[model samples]
Each structure stands twice: as structure tokens, then as C-alpha cells.
Target: MRALFRGLSPFNVTRRLYRWTMKAVRRAVEHFRRSLRLQLITTFVFCLLAALLAATLAHGMTETLYKRPYVDYTLSMQRMDWETRHLATIIRDQSETDISALQPMLDNFEQDVGLRMLLVNLDGKVLLKSAKATESQVDLYSVISRAMELRLDLNVFHPQEFVAFYPVELAGQKGYLIARGMPEANIRYESTGVNMISVPVFLVVLIYLFYRFTRRKTGYIEELADSLLVISQGKLDHRVEVRGEDELGSLARNINRMAQDLQENIERERQAEKTKNELITNVSHDLRTPLTSVLGYLRLLKDHPAGGLEQQEYTRIAYEKAEHLKRLVEDLFEYTTLSGQGVQLYRQTICMNELVEQLVEEYVPLAEEQQLSFCKALPDERLYVSVDPEKFVRVLENLFSNAIKYGKKPGSIGVTLAREADGIRLSVANRADEMAPEALNRLFERFYRVEQSRSRKTGGSGLGLAIVKSIVELHGGSIKADYRDGVLSFHIWLPVPGS
Candidate 1:
């Protein structure tokens, strides 16, 4: 029975209904927020509710200040009329005509009740007065006649006073009972006028507050519009300020991010253009010098074939210049290919220790020819790295060649390979003339060379270190150069397999 009652319980039913109602309300609210018309309608309804609430509060205050006191005054007058009737009835029942007998009772009524009363005969002549009469004499008969004609039981006793006269029958005689000296006015005319003025003033204030509220809300939209206009005028550096956590603020943040990206892209494009122009100027000068030498030597050889020994010397000079030009072009082409995003790499896991050892051995003869000593520091543990073997070998060759060309006379060229915590560290250092700190920073830029230490006699196209950097980057490695203690060092860090 308990289970049956639980299933039929009103509480359970109410909970289910509440859940459904809340779900529907949430859906409606979401819809209202998404639709502009619905949102405006909701705002209007809210403002209307606010206005109505303000009006209700004002009405309650008005009733407390004016209406209630006036109602209580009216009730007090009715009570006074009843008391007057009761006193007159007492006088008729007692059949008292002597002034002395009723004088104490009338005095007690006047003192206790705080009202002045009078009795008059059918002829409208005053027969008794409990208090002094301050007003001038009036035609009481005409007043009574007019009140009776109008069928009013009470009539105004005097102008501009809170006094009334009630007609009564006492001991088979018609007479009038007058009441005077009532309570002072509690609800004044001035207070009613103030209330009337305050209502319209309150309404005006409510409208102004609503207008400011709506205007502040829509002000964000206007800011967005102005921001878009400024951005459209090519002010990529400009950003919109975010003012809230709502959708409008999110849009402003997105616009700011877009502007930042556009500014960065534009700056990058400008730098690229400058770099392109520099590259063209450098390549043109290099190529023209070598081609002119080759052409001039070939022309001399062609015109003086019979001038035997001199002709052979001119032919040899032309051949050397042609080879130098070929090497320059090849280096340029290779650098361009490696710099491209679409260059495919044939990656394989190679033992870096063995590769370094082999490269050192290959460069030992060149070191000896240059009168530079070879120093090697390699670990026995095999370090494996995944890289394009051909490109990786080229990077090592470039460093070794540069060391051979630029090392000081009789100075030692050192090659060190070791396994670091993160990856493999390869350092190639050569004792050379101290290079400027600024030169080390730009050592890997294409066609860049330190004029003090590097020359055409080194037989390089100045793209070797740049090519090495590109290859290292393609293999997800990094390369940097440093100069310290008269030794220029190039450090390469390559990630180990699976690291």
C-alpha cells in the first residue's frame, strides 16, 4: 500500500510537472535569447513589470499618507453622530426640562466626549447650548427647511468649519442636535496636491531609467560597428576593446586576434620582399664576376692558340673559373630546394656516433693540408637519430669545410659528439680569429659572410651554413653558432629516435 501511495503521491506528481515546466522554460529562454525580436519583446515586458511595480509602491504610500486618515476621520464622525443620538434619547426618556438637573450630564458629555452640542425646538430656536457659540446668528428655520427638502438627516452647521446638525424627535417634539468643535483636519488639501504631482514625476523617472538601461545595452553594438569600420580602413594594428563576457565581447576578442595576425603577416611579407631583393643583388654580383673572368680568359685562349704556354695558362684559368661558377650555382640550387616546404626527405635511423666518426676521418686529410690539427671527442655508446642521410651528411661536411677554411694557422679543429638527456649534441669548434658577437647571430643567413674572416679564396658560395640550418630544421633539430675564447663553435642538437 505504501508503494501504491508513493506512485500516486501529489508530491511526486508535482515534482515531475515542475521538471517539465522548468525544461520548457529553459528552451523558451534560449529561443528568446537567440531571436532579436523575442529579446526585444522580453525587455519590453520586463520594463513594463518594473513600471507597474513602481506604480504599485507609489499607490501604497499614497493610501497610507492620505486615504487611510481620511477614512478614519469619516468613521469618527459617524461614531460622534451615534453618541449624540444616544444622549438625546436619554434626555427624552428622563423627560427632563429643568436646566439644573441636566447641566451636570451635559457638562460631563462635553468634557468626556470633547464635542459641543446644542438642542433646538421645532421653531428652530436654540433651547440649550453645552458650549459657547462663536459664529454669527443665522436663519436656522430656512437651513432646516432646505435640509429637509433635500431629505438630508444632517446639514452643515457653518461654512469653513467641521460642524454638523442632525434633526431628531425627543419626547414627542421635533428638534435639532448640533455638533461642533470636531478634531482638526488630518488629511490636508496640500498633501493631496503633492500626491497628484508625485505620481507623474515617478513615472517620468521610471521611463528615463529604462531608456538609459536599454541605451547602455545597445551601446556595445555601436562600438562593434565603429571598430569594424576602423579595421576596414586598413588599420591592422587597431584592436577592439572587450567590455563583457557575453557574445559581443567574444566577437571583439576574435576581431583583435584577427587584426594581430594580419599585422604580423603584413610585416613578414615586407621582410621577405627585402630579403628577396638582397638575394638577387648578391647573386647577380657573384655570378657576373665569375662569368666575366671565365669569358675573358676563354677569349684570350681562343685568339692565341699558337702562343703555346700562355694559351695553356689561359685555358687552365678559364677552367677553374667555370668550375667555381658551377659550384656557386649548384650550392644556390641546393639551398633553394632545401628551403622549400615541399622538399621530400628519405628518413632512416642512423647511428650518429658512427656517422660522426666516419665524417671526422674523411676531413682529417683536409685538416692536415690546411696545417690545422684534428681533435675528436666521441662517446662509445651508440646514439641513434632519424634523419635524411644525404642531407645530414651535407650538414656535417659544410661545418668541417668551414672549419678547414677559417681555422687559425696551426690551430686545432675539434669535433665532439655526446648523448644528452633530451637528444644528441654535436659540437664542431675551430680555433680561429675572434669573431664579432653580431656576426654569430646571423651566421646562418643565406649568402651572409663575415668580411673580416671570410673571402672568395675560401672557395664557398656562402650558402653552406644556411643549407645546414634548413636541413637541421627539416629533421626537427636546431643549430646555433657561438664564439668564445678565440674558438668559433657550431652546435647541433638532434632528437634521438623515439625521444
Candidate 2:
């Protein structure tokens, strides 16, 4: 009994019921959020219910108007006609024999039918009345007089009032019996045949309209599904037709964006694959050339082992080829490492002005050897930036070496470092023959050279600029080359503090 009572505890039961109710409410809310069709259906049902309630209220209000104490017009004209005729027959039979008994009968009939009743003699003298005359009943006397003068029965009806008069004889005397009240009110009920038919017709029309509305939504959904199918079949250009600024429209927009992004990614992948193939081919050819040269020279030395001078010349040539091969291999390794996705940079806050000055000084002799003069435009202030010192040095060295190698003979190599609005800009400018726009655009691409023959003559591996660009980007910097007025300048922009 204790366990049963505990199980039936009102507090526990209420808490459990509350939890279940909340869970159900959350699920309903989630479904409402996710399903557009459900939302539309809910709205459609609510509108129908509201319309039904309004119709019911209107019918009830009409009936209530008739049922009001002062307004007695709900009785139909046909019912009024029947009641009047029945009262006329009774008065004809009883009024002539027992005029005293007719007063009681008329009063009772007045109470039953809710009408004002009066009896008057031919001269218009009131002999009997069911109730006191009020303003609405003032017209009853005229109706009785008209009937008496005409010697005929009369029925007059209006929206607010009705008056009926009948010629009658009371104990050998002639008089008029008048009935005054409101006319029948216009009211509809569900039980009537007209209302029954109209209700079904209204429901049919409502259902048809709702069906059309839902069909439009379902049709759009089907179109979206079809577009998705087309996209799944690799037609990334296919798009959904956005109809309105609703959830469906947003969904369509998202689908279109997804398709566009997918298309772009596919094109990029294809380009990357093509680049990979070119890289393999270029690497094999570059590596094989020096390796073959080294092997040929070594073979010559091996075959002519006794000729000391010739052997030394061949050994030197082979050694130079080996060194070239070693440099190419090192550059290739560095390029691959820097181009990797997870390359780590050991960053430090270093003064870029001091670093550029130091590098310029170190390369001054090499610039002189190339018949190129250094034109330094270093900033006076110590502009600081966070970068991997070693990698940043390599970037500058690559640009400087390229400028020295390809610059016009006896021309000046401009090395500039300055502070800009957004960041610090470092540039290496050289006077060279005007390069084509296509070549300038691909200057930082792997294994790309302005002149393949000149690059081979200078013993360049062609990965230098590519590696430079990768390192600069790793430090949250950008590099670009521009050619104008026979001057090719490469600019590097680094965003850092203390500038």
C-alpha cells in the first residue's frame, strides 16, 4: 500500500508528466524548424479552423439577435400566416357565442406566440387587450380601423413590426381583432437543406485551394531534388530556381554555391595534376643531364688513367658537374620541404633594416663580379618583423642572385626597404630586357625561367624563385614581380608590428 501510494504521489507524477511534456514539445519544435511542409500544413489547418469558427460564431450571433427579449422576429412568415389563420378560425367560432371567454383565450394565445393582441368594436373603441400598448403597438389601432372600414382582413408586415386584423362578431356585435409583432428574421441553421449543401460546397472549394497551394510547394521541392540529382551525376553547373526569399530560396542558394565551389575545386585539382606531371618530367631531365655529364667525364678519366694532366682536367670537369648536380638536388629537396602543407617556421622578431643591410654588404662583392652595382635604399629606422631568420635570408639571397645573374651588364641593382601604410615593403630591382606579361606572371612558378637556355648557361635550377615565394607566404607575407621601363622589380610585403 505504501509503494502504491508512492507510485501515485501527485508531486512525482506531476514532475514525470512535466518532463515528458517538455521532451515532446522540444521534439515538435525541432520538427517544425526542420520541415517546411509541416509548417505550411500547420498554417493551412489553422486557417481552416479559424474560418470554421468564424462561420459558427456568425450563425450563433444571428440566432442570439432573434432570441433577445425585445426582438421577437425569428418566427418565419409561413409560421406567422398559419398562426394568424388558426386564431381567426377560433375567434370566428367563439367570439359570436361567448365574447367574455374570448378575452382569456386571446391573452393566453398572446403569451404563447409573443404578439400584442387587441379587440375593438366597429367605431374603434377598444373592448379587450392582451397587454398594455407600447410605442411599437401604436400602429395596431389604425390597422383595426382600416379593417373595419374595408370590412376585410388585413396583414401588414415590416422589418421591425407586423400587424394583422381580422373581422369578428362578439355576442351580436361587430369588431376587429388585431395582432402586432415583428416579422420573421433571416437566419440559417446547419439542419436546413440549403445550409447542409452550402457547407459541403464551401469545404470542397477550401480543400481544392489548399491542394493547389501545397502542390506549388511540393513542385518546387521536386525541382530542387532533380537539380541535386543532376549535380550528383557530375553536372556541377546545374542550379535550382529560387522562387522566394524563404527557406527554400536559401536552400537553393546554398546548393548553387556548393556547386560553384565544387566546380572550382575540381578545376584546381586538374591543374595541380598537370603541374605534378610537368614537375616530374622537368626533374628527371635536369637531374639526368648533369649525372650523364659527370659519368662521361669520369669514364674518360678511367680510360686514360696514365695521362696525369688529362686525368686532372677530366677529374675537375667531373667534380664541377657533381657539384652542380648536388646543388640541384639540394634545391629540389628544399623546394619540396617548403611547399609541404605542414612546414614549420622558427619565427623571431628581427630588424628588417639591419638584416637587409647585412645581406647587401655580403652580396656586394658578388654584384661587383657580375659587373652590377648595388643601389641601396635602406630605411633609417629599425623596422622589425617576425619571421624565420634563416628562411627569410634565403628569400633575399634568391632575389639578389637572380637580379645579379639576369641584370644588364654594368647596370645598377636597386635594393630597397621601406615602411608602408599596411606593412614593410622590401624590393630588389634590376635593369633587364622588358619581359612579357606571361613570363612575369609565372616567375614564381616551380621550374619556370624567363629564358631556358640562359638559365641553363647560368647553372640555375629554376626552383629558387618558387622557394622564395613559399617562404615569404609562410611568414604571412606576399611577393609579386612587375616590369616597367626596362626594369624588372620583385616586391615583398610583410605585415608585422614595430614598423
Against the true structure, whose TM-score is highest?
2
- Candidate 2 residues lying further than 4 Å off, grouped into runs, are 1-85, 93-163, 168-175, 179-326, 337-350, 362-372, 385-391, 408-411, 420-423, 431-441, 452-455, 473-477, 482-487, 494-499
The global C-alpha lDDT for each of the candidates, from Candidate 1 onward, is 0.75, 0.77
Which tens-of-lDDT digit does each residue in 221-325 have in candidate 1? 898889889988989888898865556767889999988998899889878965874585467556767677776767666666656787678677766767777
Candidate 1 regions exceeding 4 Å error are: 1-307, 452-454
Residue pairs with backbone overlap in model 1: none
- Candidate 1, number of clashes: 0
What TM-score does candidate 2 get on C-alpha atoms? 0.50
At residue 456, what lDDT does model 2 achieve?
Answer: 57
TM-score versus the correct structure, for each prediction: 0.48, 0.50
